[model samples]
Target: MADKKPDSPSHEPPRGPILVPVDFSAHSEAALLLASDFADGLGCKLAVLHVVHDPQNMPGYYARMAGKKTLTRMADIAGEMLDEFMAKVQKRHPERHALHKAEVLLVKGIPVTRILQVVEKEKASMVVMGSKGATGLRHLLLGSVAEQVLGLAKLPVTIVKEQPKY
Candidate 1:
């Protein structure tokens, strides 16, 4: 038998799917497109995630007063919205056939925490998300989910900024 080269690359399959967080914004569309490209190039799966922050978790006392029925209804609506959003994305980016294989997920919780949890749970190879690029008081008060994910994620994270139409 011929001796094999020690340094030859092994043809191992991709380790995990690429995770994309979509908030159904223009920025998120851009990120989704970028992720589609990555998934196609890497021959890996794609997972699209949308996190709906619970209104009951808001700081205001009134916001925190949501009952179980209200919370359940909200979650159901969010799930429907997520489904519609994914359908739109698929329709809009028909050329990106990799998106057809995407697994869409909807979860309720703090956005950043849920995102990270999904990444770990799914064994994602990388994360792609959009940044609204909020600044000043808004950034300080609301905080940026993309920024938090970038800081906390153990895997590679790509943040795509929305491009102006004009």
Candidate 2:
């Protein structure tokens, strides 16, 4: 009779898509580059997510008059902004196509909550985001969206620390 041997761990590599949340900031650009590197190394896809929070919920007089006209104007502005951002990124990183195709998604809601929603919808294996570092009393008082998302999301999160000098 032959003795049974323990099974060895499979050598299969981790495979899945990577999602990057962008706010069209320099920090976001850094995070996108990081995500691109990871995606290229892992042979995964990269998706860019931008959340356009509903202005109605924002604390201000704008919330009081969130009528059709106001909403339309806001949507138009958001669309233009997103378009410009995508164009700039595309222009800046022409070599990005070699790594992986990009996706631009525009959603509305609380930034962190919307991000989590997209993560679930996309079935992303991991998320990359930029941390706009807040210091001292500001950090303590307002808190950070990156930190909030880091604590809340179920999947792994890669936080790209912004340059402290900037």
Candidate 3:
């Protein structure tokens, strides 16, 4: 009888970019770094997203009081900050060739909702974000965006937490 070859498993390439949401925090920076490495390894693009939470969406009197002009200005400032953040990332990871194809995205909306929207719109293969690891009242009030994303995202989600200081 002729020798038979064993069946080999297929290795499928990643379908879309890796999404990293940043809030200009150190934890977010760590997430960006980790996502960059993953993107390089997977030969996929990296998308750095920053969401400007709309003040108009705030509950109670504040939402009603916020004017359109003020909301516009806030969005503009957020865009500027996002640009600065991207610049810093570029400076820090100048040697990361994969980042050459990275896209910086700034959008206005609730953070978690906008993030999920972008993930679907961008067809992201995975989401990597930082968790502040908030606890107690702060966590209850603000809610954890990473946790929400992890629960809701259809694709893989990676939450990078800051290492504890000695």
Best by lDDT: 1
Candidates arranged by lDDT, highest first: 1, 3, 2
lDDT of each residue in 52-113, candidate 2, tens digit only: 77656444423333454565555455666667777887788887762237777888778899
lDDT by candidate, in order shown: 0.84, 0.76, 0.83
Ranking by TM-score: 1, 3, 2
TM-score of every prediction relative to native? 0.80, 0.76, 0.80
Q: After superposition, how far is residue 34 of candidate 1 from its true place, in Å?
A: 0.6
True-structure RMSD, every candidate: 4.7, 5.1, 5.2
TM-score of 1: 0.80
- Estimate the lDDT of model 2: 0.76
lDDT of each residue in 58-147, candidate 3, tens digit only: 533222223544554666766766777778877988988766678989887888999999999999999999998889997888779999
Q: Which ten residues in a row are the worst by lDDT in model 1?
A: 59-68
True lDDT of residue 95, candidate 1: 85
Instruction: Please tell me which model should have the higher TM-score, number 1 or number 2.
Output: 1
Q: Write the per-residue lDDT of candidate 1 for residues 43-113, one digit (tens) a residue.
A: 89999998878656543322232343455566666666668778888898888877988998988788999
Residue clash pairs of candidate 2:
none
